[model samples]
Target chain A: MNLIEILSYGFIQRALLAGTLIAVLCSVLGVFLVLRRLSLIGDGLAHVTFGSTAIALALQLYSAASLLVSLPVVLLASLGILKLTEKARLNGDAAIGIVSAVGISIGIMLASVGGGYNVDLLSYLFGNILSISYEEVIIAAGLFCVVMVLLWLFFHDLLAISFNEELARVSGVRTNLISAVLVMLTALSVVLAMKLVGIMLISSLLILPAVSALQLARSFRACIVLAALQGGCSVVAGIFVSFLTNLPTSAMIVMINLLFFCCSCGVRRLITIRNIG
Target chain B: MPVEIVATERLACGYREGYVLEDISFTVNAGDYVGIVGPNGSGKSTLVQALLGLVPISSGSARLFGSRCDNFSQWGRIGYLPQSLHLLNPIFPATVAETVALGLLSLKRFPRRLTRQDRETVETTLDVLGVYDIRSKLIGELSGGQQQRVLLARALVNDPELLILDEPTAALDPETRERFYHMIADVNRSRGVTVLLVTHDTGVIGQHASKMLYLDKRMLFYGGFDDFCHSPEMSSLFGEHSQHLMCHRH
Candidate 1:
C-alpha cells in the first residue's frame, strides 16, 4: 500500500503515535541521564524488561498484562542499580553490567525453557510496529504527558542536581528524592518505548537524540528543546522510511537516529572551526 | 551578641567506611569573614557539608540559622559554592546567565519561573562579578577564573545571609585569586553576609579573614588570625615556616 493508504490503518496510526511519544519521552529524560553520566542505565533497565517479558510469556500472560508485570520489576531494578552504585560503592558501569547480565540470562533461560522463541516473544525482542495496539498507544500518550509534566515541575531541581548534586542538596532541592524520581521516570520511559524499539535498540532512542542536541545546543534549555525536536522528527521519519522500505521498524528508527547524530557531529565541527576562524 | 549563623557542637561526620571528621566544634556568627584552612583530606569539605546538611553528623549537633541541621529547611537564606564547580562536565550546556539563574530558581517553589526581579538580581550579580560581558556565553567556553566568577555570581544571586565556599579559588591564578578574595571581603563587609571560606591558603586567610578555622581531621585552631599566628597548634603543625610566613605578611 502507498503512504496515504497505510496511514488509513488504525494499527499504523497507533504505532506512529506511540513511537513519536516514546521518542519525545526518551529524549527529554535522556538529556538528564547523559549529563549525569547514567546513559547506560537505560540499557540495563531495557534488559530487565526483556527478562520480565520472558517470564510473562512463559506464564502465558497477555501482552498488556506482561507489560504491567514488567513495570514494577524494572522500577525496582532502576532503584537497585542506583543504590548499588551509590551506597554499595560499586562503579556505575559495573552495577549496570551485573544487572544487565542477570536480566539477559534470565530472559534467555526462560525463553529456552518455555517452549522456545514463539511469535509473540520474537515480536517483543525485535519490535514489530504493525503489532502495536490502540491500548498501548493510549498508554504511551498518558506516560508522555506524565513525564513531560513532571520534568516541567522539577526542571530546575533536576538541572541543579545534574550540574552539582552536593550544591543542589545544600540548596534544599531534595536531591535524593529528585534523583529517585528521575530514575523512576527513566524506567517508565524505557518500558514504554520497548514495543517501539525493542530491547536491543531501546537505549539508542534514549541517548542519540540528546547527544545530537548537545552537539548543537549551547544552553541546557536549548539542549532539551532541540533533543525533543530531533527525537520527534527522527521517529516520524523512521516510521515513514520503514513503511516504504518494509524494514524492521525498530532497526530503521535507530538507524535514522544514528544518521542524525552523525550529521550533528559534523555540524558541531563546522561551527567550532568557524568560531576559531 | 552577634547572631550565630552556623554552630556545630562536637560535630563528627564520615562516610560509610570511616570518619573523616571527629569532635569538630566551631561557631560562625553573622558578619564574620571566617576562612577555613586545612590540608588535603583534612575534612574541611566534610565539615562544610555537615553544616549544609549534605552529610549526616554521626555525633553532636549542627545548627544553621538557629535551627537544627536536620530540621533546617531555609536553604534560600544561605549560599553554597561547592569545590566541584570548576570540575564540572567539560561540555555542560549552560550559559553564564542560566547558571547564575539556577541559584535563584532553585529556591523558588516548583514550576519555578524567573521573575523580573530575579532576572535583575542575576544581572546585577553577574555585573558585580565582572562576568556580565560573558553572561550569554556557554559556561564550558569560559576560562577557569571566569567560570569561578560565574559560580560566585550564582552563589551571590540569592542574596544569602551566609555564604559557604569550598576552595572556590583553587583553580584561579594568583591575580584572580587575590581579586576574588577582595570581592568576597567586599560582600562580607558591605552586605553583612557571613562568609565561611574553605581554603588551603593560610596566607590568604591571614590577609582577608577576620577569623580563622585551622583544621587537620579535627579543629586544630579556631580564633582570630592574630591568635592563630601565635597559637601553639599553628607552630607545631607548620613548624617555623608558618611563623616566617606570618611575619612576611605583616
Candidate 2:
C-alpha cells in the first residue's frame, strides 16, 4: 500500500496519535527518573503491569476494562517501591528487583494455571498498536494532559528534588509527597504505555530518548524539549516505517529511538572536537 | 530577651547503623553568628540536619522559630547550604541563574512560578555574590569556587533571616576561603541574618562567630569564643598546647 493508503485507515490514525502521546509522557518523565537513578522504575513497573494484566485477563477483563484492575495495583506497587527504599532501607535497584520479581512470577503462575488465555496474553506481551481503538486514543490524550499538567505545576519542585533531595527538602518542597506523585505518575504512564510499546519494551520508551537528550542539551529545558521531540518523532516514524516494512510497530519505535540516541552521541563527539579545535 | 531562632534541648539523632548525635542542647537567638566546630565524624552535620527535620530526632526536642522542628513550616526564613557539593550530579544541566532562582522557591506557595520580580531578585543576588557575569553558565561547567558562590547566592536570594551552612568552604583555596568567611560575616553584620556555620576551621570561624559550639557526638562546649578559650573543659579536651594554638591564630 502507498503512504496515503496507509494513512487513510482510521485505526492507523488512532495508533499514531495515541503512540505519540504516550511516548512523550514517558520520555519527559524519564528525564527526571534517569537523573534520580530510578530509571529502572519504568521496567520494574512494567513487569508489575504484566502481572496485573494477567490477573485482569483471568477475570475476563480485556482492552480498557483491564485498566480497571491494573491501574490501582500498579499505583500501589509504585508506592510500595518507594516505601521499600525509605522504610525498609533497601536500595532503589534492590527494591525494584524484588517487586519486579514478584510481579512477573505471579503473572507466570496465573498464565500456567489458567492455561487457554495464552493467545490473548501474548498480544499484550508484545503489543498490537495498529489495533488501537478510538476510546484508547481518548484515554491516551487524557493521560497525557494529566501527567503534563501535574509536571508543569510541580516543575521547580521536581527539578529541585532531582538535583538534590536534601536541599529540596530544606527548601520545603514536600519531598515525600512529590516523590509519591512522581512514582504514581510513572505507574500510570507504564500501564497506559504497555499498549503502545508492549510490556517488555515499555522501559525503552521511557529511557532511550531522555538519555539521548542528556548527551547534547546544554540546559534542562532544552533537554526536556529534545527528549519529547525525539519521543514523538520516533513514534510517528515507527508507525509509518512498520506499516511499510511489515515489521512489528512497537519494536520499530524502540529501534528508531536507539537510532536517535546514536545520532545524539555522534553529534556530541563532533561538538567536543570542534570546541577543542 | 532576643527571639529564639533555633532551640534544641537534649536532641539526639541517628541512622539505622547507630547514633551519630546525642545530648545536644543549645539555643541560637536572632542575629547570632554561631560556629559549629567539630572533628571528623563529630555529628556536626547530623545536628544541623536534625534541626531542619531532614533527619529524625531519636529523642528530645528540636524547635525552629518556636515551632517544633517536625512541624516547622517557615522555610522562607531560613537558607541552607549542605556540605555535599561533590554529591551533585556533574551534568545536572542547571544554569547558575536557574540554580539561584530556585532559592526563591521557598517563599512561594502552590503553582510556584517565578515572576519577573523573582528573576530580578535572582539577578541581584547573583550580582551581590559577584556571579552575575557567569549567570548563564551551566553549574557543572563552573570551577569549584564559582559553584560555591553560585550556591551561596542561592542560599541568600530569598533574603532569609537565618543561614545554615555545613562545611561551605571545604573545597575552596585559602584566599577564596577567607573571602567566603568575610562575605558571610558581612551578611550577618549588615543584614542581621542569623548564622549557624559548621566547619573544621575553628580558628578562622572564631574571628567571625560570636559563639562557638564544639561537638564530638555530644555538646562538648557551647558558649562565647572568649569563654571557650578560657574554659578548663576545652583546655583539657584539646590539650593546653593545641587549645592555645587554636585560640591564638589570627
Candidate 3:
C-alpha cells in the first residue's frame, strides 16, 4: 500500500482525525484548568471517563453513546463533590482524590466482571490511539466544533472568570454560569480525548501546552493561539515518532509535551537572565 | 433611600461546629466608607463571603443591589475584592490590563469579546490608579504594591455602584496603603461608587471612613467612626499606642 492508503486505513485515519480534534478541544480547556490549578481535576475526570467507558462496555452500548451518557453523569458527580466540599467540612482536594480512586476501582472491577477480556484494559487506560474508528473521529470533531464556537463567543468572560471568579461575578460577569459552562466543557473534552490521549496521559495534554503558552503569550489572544499550536505540534510529532520507533502514541505525546515544557522553562529563564544582565 | 448597595440582617455564619459570628445587621449606602474591623478569627472573612453568598449564611438574609446575594446572574453590577487575595494564583501570566478587564467580562454575552468599551474602562481605571504605563506588564513581574493595585483596579474596572473590598490595603506598605486609601476615596467621591472595606487599619479608617463595624464575637459596634474610636472598649482595644494610629494619616 502507498503512504496515503496506509494512512487512510480506517483505524489510522480515525486516530489522526480524532487526535487532532481532541487535541484542540483539550488544549483550550487546559488553558483554564492549568491556570486555575485544576490540572488534578483533569486527571480526576479521566478516571471518571474510564468508569463511563466500562459501564458502556458492560451495557453493550456504542462507545460514543457511553461517552455522551457518562459525560454529564461524571460532571454531575464532580459537581456534587464541589458542592459537598463547599457545604461540608471536607478538604476539596482530598474529596476529589477519594472520588478519583473510587471511580477507577469501580471501572476496573466492572470491566473484569463483564468479561470483555478481549479488550485490553491496559491499552485503553493508556490510550488506544491506533484502535480509533472513523465513527469516533466524526463524533470528536463535532464536539470540538461546539466547544470552539462557545469559547469564541465567551472568550472575554471565560478569561476573566478563570483569572478571578469572584471578582468576575462582581464586575458583572455571570461567574456561576461561566464556571458551570467551563466544567461542562472540560468534561466533554475529556470524553472526546480519552480515546486518543488515553485516560492516563490525557491530563498532560490538558495542561502542558497551556503552561508552555502561558510562558510565551503576551496577550490572551496570543495565548490561545499558541496553546492550540503547541497541542497540534505535540500530537503530530508524537504520532510520527511512535510510527517510526514502534512506540505507543500516547506515551510519545506526553514525552513530547514534557520536552516542550522543559524548553519553555529554559527559554523563559534565559530571557529573564538576559533582561537582568 | 437611594437604594442601599449592600444590606444584611442577623446574618450568622461559622463552621459546622458552631457560629463564630451572629446577629449582625447593617447597610452600606452610597458614598459610605464602611470599615469592618475586628480581631483575627472573629469571622470577618466569613461575613464577607456570606454577604456575597459564597459562604452560606446560617441564619438571616443578605442582599446586594436589591437581590439575594448568592444569585450571581445579576452580579455584573457589583464589585468585590476579596482579602487574602495574596494566596491566589500569583504566577499566572496575566497583564495588568487583562487582569483588570476580567471585572467587566460579564457585561456582554458570548460572541463579542472584550469590546472597546471594556478596554476603555480598564485603561481609565488603570490610569486612575496611576498604573496606566504598566498595563501590559505581567502581574508576576510587579512588586507587592503594584500587584495589590492591579487587583484593586480589577475590582474597580466595572465601575459598579458599590465597591466591596475585603482588607483592600492589608498587604501594602504604609505609603502604598495611603495611596490606595486615597484612590478608594476618590472613586467614592468622583464616581459616586459606594464603598465598604474590611480593614484592621483603624488609623486609615479614622481619616476616610464615615462608618465602622467593630467585630469580635459579633457586630460589637456598628456606627460612626468617631464614636467607634472614642468608646472606652474600642479605645482600650487599641491600647496606649492608639494615639499613634490617630495621627497616622498624612
Candidate 4:
C-alpha cells in the first residue's frame, strides 16, 4: 500500500488520533508536574493503572469496560499517594516508590494466577498502537478536550501554586484544592495514555517533552506551547516510523522524544556560547 | 490613635516537634515601619509565618486589619516577600513581567486576564524598581540583586496596605541593601503602608525603621528605635554592640 492508502486504514487513523490527543494532553500537564518537581508521580500512577488493568483482565472484562474499572482505581491511588506524603510525613519519593512497588507486585501476581500472562497482557506492557479501536479514540479525544478546557480555566492558579505553594496559599489561591485537581488530572491522563504508551514507558510521554521545552523556551507560556507541539510531532512521527519499521510504537515514540531533548540541549548550549562570544 | 494593622496577643506557635516562639505579643499600627531584628533560630521567620496564617497558632489569637487570622480573606490588601526567593525553582521558565504579574493573581477571578490597570500597575512597579528594561528577560537570567528587585516589584505591584518582608536583603550587596531600605522607607512614608520587615542586619534597618522589634525565641523589646537603644533589654541582649548597631547615622 502507498503511504496515503496505508494511512486510510481505520486502525491506523484511530491510532494516530488517539496517540496525538494523549501526547498533547500529557505534555501540557507535564509542564506543571515537571516545574513542581512531581514528575515521578506519573510513573507511580502508571504502575497503579497496570495493576488495575490486570484485575480487569483477570475478571474477563471487555476492552472498553476495562477503562471504566481502571480509571477510578488509579484516581483513588493517586489521592492516596498524595495523602500519605502530606499527612503521613513520608517523603514524596518514598511514598511513590511504595505505591509503585505494591502495584507492580499485584499485577505480577494477578498475571501469574490468571493463566500465566497471555499475549493480551504483554501488549499492555509494551504498547500496541495497531490495537487501538474507534471507541478508545473517541474516549481519548473527549478527555483531551476536557483536560484542555479545565487547564485553561485554572492556568493562573496552577501556575501560582506550581511556582510557590506557600506564597500561593498566602495569596488566597486555594493551594490544597489546586494541588488535588492537578493530581487528579495527572491520574486521568496516565490512565488514558496506558494504551498509547503502556504502563512501563508512560512517564516518558509526561516528562521528556516538557523538560526539552524548558531548555529552549524563555517564558512559561512558551514552554507549554512548545512542549505540546513537540509532543504532537513526536507522536505522529513515531507512529509513522513504527508503521514503516514494524517496531514497538511506544518505544519508538520515546526514542523520538529523547532525540528532541538532545537537540534542545544542543541549541541551548549554542545560544549560551553565542552570547558569550 | 492610629488604627492597628496587626495585633497578636500572647501568641504561642511552633512546629509538631516543639515551640519555637512562645508568649509573643506585639501590635503594629497604621504607617508604622517595624523592623524585627534577631539572630538565627530566634523564630523571626516563624513569627512572620504565624502572622500570615501560614503556620498554625498553637495558642492566643492574631488579627489582621481588624479580622481574626483564620477569618481574614483580604490577602490582596497585604504584600509579602518571603525570606528566600531561592524557594522558586531556578529552572522554571518565567519572564520578569510574567513573574511580576503573578502578584495580581489574587485580585482577579479564575482564568485571570490582566486588565489595563493591572498592566499599568506592573509596569509602574517595574519602573519604580528600575527593572523595566529587563521586563521581557527570563527571571533565571538575572543577577542576584536584579532578581531581588524584581521580587520586590512583584510584592509592591498590588498596592498593598501592609507590606511584610522576611529577610529580603539577605543576599544583596551593601549598596543594593541600602537602596532597598530606602525604597521601603519611601513606601512607608509616602504611601502610608504599614511595614513589617524581618532582618538580621540591625544597623541598616535601624537607620530607616521608626520602630524596632527585638526577638530571641520571644519578644525581647518592641518600641520606638530610640527606646530600643535606651532599653535595658537591648543592652543586656546585645551587650556593647547594641548601641553601635542601633545608633548608626540616618
DockQ of 1: 0.69
Which candidate has the highest lDDT of all? 2
Can you give the TM-score per candidate against the true fold? 0.95, 0.97, 0.88, 0.97
The runs of at least 3 residues in candidate 2 whose Cα sits more than 4 Å from the true structure, single-residue gaps closed, are B15-18
A29-147: candidate 4 lDDT, tens digit per residue = 99999998889999999888888888988888757678987889898988888888889999878888988888888888888888654667767887777788888888898988899
Model 2 pairs whose backbones collide: none
Which ranges in model 4 have alpha carbons more than 4 Å from their true place?
Answer: B240-242
What's the TM-score of chain B for every model shown? 0.93, 0.97, 0.89, 0.94
Candidate maximizing DockQ: 4
**Residues forming the 10-long window of minimal summed lDDT in candidate 1 chain B:** B241-250
Q: Give residue B17's error in model 1 in angstroms.
A: 6.4
**Where's the lowest-lDDT run of ten residues in candidate 2 chain A?**
A118-127
Cα lDDT tens digits, model 3, B1-250, are: 5568788888888776999889989888877888888889887877887877667777788888778877745656667777644535766777888888877754655554777777888889899888999998888778878888887787777667778788876777888878888888888888888888888777777888888888885888888877765677766766646634653542
Q: Classify candidate 1 by CAPRI docking class.
A: medium
Question: What fraction of the native interface does candidate 2 get right in terms of contacts?
Answer: 0.66
Docking class of 4: medium
Give the poorly placed runs of model 3, Cα more than 4 Å off.
Answer: A1-12, A61-84, A87-89, A172-177, B1-3, B65-77, B109-112, B229-250
Position B105, candidate 4: lDDT: 83
**Using alpha carbons, what is the TM-score of model 1?**
0.95
lDDT tens per residue, model 2, A11-110 = 9999989999999999999999999999999999999998999999999998988899999999999999999999898999999999999988889999
Which residue pairs in candidate 3 have backbone atoms (N, alpha carbon, C) closer than 3 angstroms, thus clashing?
A: A153-B110, A153-B111, A172-B76, A173-B106
Give per-residue CA lDDT, model 1, range B10-83, as digits (tens).
Answer: 88998778889988888888899998877799999888888877777899999999999988989889888887
